[model samples]
Target: MLPTTRGDFWAEITQIGMDRLWMQRFHVSLPQVSTVASRPGRRSIGFLTECNSSPLQHCGLNVLSGDIIVNKFDLAHHRSGADYHLGTMSLPTDELDTAVEVIIGRELLKSPDQRIVHPHPALMSRLLKLHKAVGQLARDTPDILERPEVARALENELVHVMVRCLAEGASADTTTGVRRHDAIMARFEEFLEANPDRPLYLTEICAAIGAAERTLRASCEEHLGMGPIRYLTLRRMHLVRRTLLHSDPSKVTVTQVVTDHGFWELGRFSVAYRMLFGESPSCTLRRPAEQPNIHLSRPSSLTTAEPRAT
Candidate 1:
């Protein structure tokens, strides 16, 4: 059970004998004046939007202020105002949301792990427009919670519409070969997992994946919500934190562990590690032994400059 500032929201663990999947729900209530903080995670099919008519900050990297709704395929980091609810279908990592109703609505009628790679600008525009429309409908539809069936129907309809829009406008990018995008991502993931303790350069990852730097970067941006190096660095940090808490500190020096995970620059690694985990690597090592668990804290506000909304 992680203790979020809002309260103690228990992380749920669903275990089928030995197989297990962890999930959690977070409901944050902030004073109207406070700025929402940015959080990170893996790509998920989930819904996150303002409730009770609040402005959305940093929508799509363009700071859009309005009641904006988002059904994101890739990972996102943002702040929000007003009370928000989240649900997770699988893991309860900081990267997952607890808005299961919204995720199921979108993913039920679509392919598994639906991802957009090399999305055409036209298609991206239409999808955003559809999202806006659905969000409006949701806001206007009153007493949705009063009738569960009606609420479910409406959510399902919105998902269907969004999926149709994506299918209609999506086109293959001839330059990158859209079909091979997933393969590249798989290779990248494998590489990251195998070398989680080593510092990795974007060029090195591109070489390992056998793709040009531009191509690799484009796909990473489209599918992972960040460039390859950023994603890998975060992943490495996550692993290192986990190891520090669960393994014997005497066996692994902090420098060796972090550098082995592909983080060559000591200063940068220390700063990022401290920023993400909410403590220095040395501090984590000195703490008394505890259960194996890791929670990557949201970065400080200064590191995230608000993007201009398009």
Candidate 2:
């Protein structure tokens, strides 16, 4: 994952593995691209674990509190505006597929379309409590889960609630406008990735991606909460940091790295870099590489991130 916001990134992650399912909790700082890729044989879902927190953007739509997003056959993108607390659960398709069909009177894997399911408030409350309880148990009293019967009961209950949510959820299908903008953003990202080392012009990007400037701008604003140029600069600032952190000072000069990433305005680049990273490029180059503090994460080259407007 790439760092989207300024300063050092921080996060904390916790996970518990069951016989066939896994539950995870993530407390992350900064809004960065978080993706769930289709496993082909497994299914996954994520939700806001905290009460009344800011909504996470799922394919350009806001995923409100208590709402769940289920991943389908393609890469799914989720972006947050700032710090977020989230929980997730996943199991093999075959494991829960049968249970879901039996209880819901429908097949879970029949459709490959990703979905946002808003479970009824009362039912979702129970699910969230159980999910939160499970996470709490795993953290403070993991030995309690060592009991086979206890573990089995929890897993069974978890599955039951999951199925109930799916059965009762008021599902929202992707709108035509959202889908079109999502596709445009995807194409725009592909183009940027294809030409990583060069300074990109907006006109050139629009032409190559076959999107009008206005559409591309709108897509970026919706998904990333920033305009294209702002995002590009934010993206490169972090890229430069990544390179500096890894490069050997004896072998590489800062200039080579900065220019290589397509920045030519050395005068302004230094100021922006310091403003975003809270350090001089040379200082970062000299410091030792450090691991991310706290939670779970990574950003993509084409990943979505929302930076505050200047």
Best by TM-score: 2
RMSD for each model, in Å, please? 12.7, 5.4
Over 1-310, each residue of candidate 2 has an lDDT whose tens digit, in order, gives 4446664366657777777777877766666765455567887888998875556887677888989987663565677856688888888988888878778777753433447888999888988999889877776667787778888899888988988887778788776777778778778777776877889999998898888999989988887777878877777777887888889999999999999988999889999888877778999999876644332222100112222211
Error of 2 at 53 (Å): 2.4
lDDT of 1 at 100: 37
Q: What lDDT, from 0 to 1, does candidate 1 have?
A: 0.43
How much lDDT does each candidate structure score? Answer: 0.43, 0.75
Q: Which 10-residue window in model 2 sums to the lowest lDDT?
A: 296-305
Tens digits of per-residue lDDT, candidate 1, 1-310, equal 1111232122211111101122123334431111122234432222232234233222113222121223232323333343543322223233122333344343322343333322344544443454444333333443342355654554454444343434443322223254356457657766765776555778888899898899877766654456777766655665676667666777878887777666778898888766655678888877764442332222200111111100
TM-score of model 1 (CA atoms): 0.44
